[model samples]
Target: MNLEPMAGFLTFWAWWVAALVLAAVETVAPGAFMLWLGIAAGLTGFVTLATGLGWEGQLAVFAILAIVSVLWGRKWAKRHQGSGPSSVSRRADQLPGRAVVLVEPILHGTGRAELDDTVWLVTGPDAPAGTVMRIVRTEGATLIVEHIG
Candidate 1:
């Protein structure tokens, strides 16, 4: 008898489902792309409720929402996020600046040294055992070195 409003409601439901599913996917992936898509869908549904746009206009609105969300998200990430050091890597970095003694002399730019009874895997500048070395840098669980000679 009368299905136009019912159809509109169904379209609204479609938008809601799409938004929810995309949001859930975003939660699992944690990259923000799908999250933005979900926001777009939800916004499109909201606009549809207020404006009751035709199907083509609804699609256009969805596209605009997605594009804006992604662009905004990118800007937000750049400002608020960083390639800052993680806890473990920062600890390893702290090691290199410390003092260590050459328990094994560096020969040909490779050797072992001791720092607080833990042997430091070292590199750079040959130095005899009993000589002191300083951490120049770190290389993957190994400490690069500079010989005091």
Candidate 2:
């Protein structure tokens, strides 16, 4: 109920302490949300130390900084969204142009081929078992191949 004592206890250093707490929270449960708030608090501490702003002004500055940092972070994330390394989990995408030996004879434009530890359904011209084929493309779970020799 009494605010005078609490208001006297809040200093510029209190903002810096709040920033550190927010940063620790960000590390434990991260999605960049608390990170921006921490940054805002850190900047507010610096501004408070330099300008000696009242509590009202400090709150205003922190609110503005938090909004700006979050919006900027979102825009930055969107711009870099497609610039990461290509996914290696899609085994089919990496199969094209690679050669594989047919494990089952192709009788009607379909057969099975072994590559690595997996057997893949293949579709192409008729080929005997043990014949080598190069993957040209993929159709769903099937590999489309062409004769290698």
Off by over 4 Å in 2: 1-10, 78-86
Summing lDDT over every window of 10 consecutive residues in candidate 2, give the lowest-scoring window: 3-12
Candidate 1's TM-score: 0.71
Off by over 4 Å in 1: 1-9, 83-96, 114-118, 128-132, 139-142, 147-149
Tens-digit lDDT track of model 1 for 49-96: 777777999999999999999999888877787557566657886775
Per-model TM-score, in order, reads 0.71, 0.72
Model 2 C-alpha lDDT per residue in residues 19-95, reported as the tens digit of each score: 99999999998677888898899989888877778889999999999999999978887787655455765667888
How many backbone collisions does model 2 have?
Answer: 0
Worst 10 residues of 1 by lDDT: 81-90
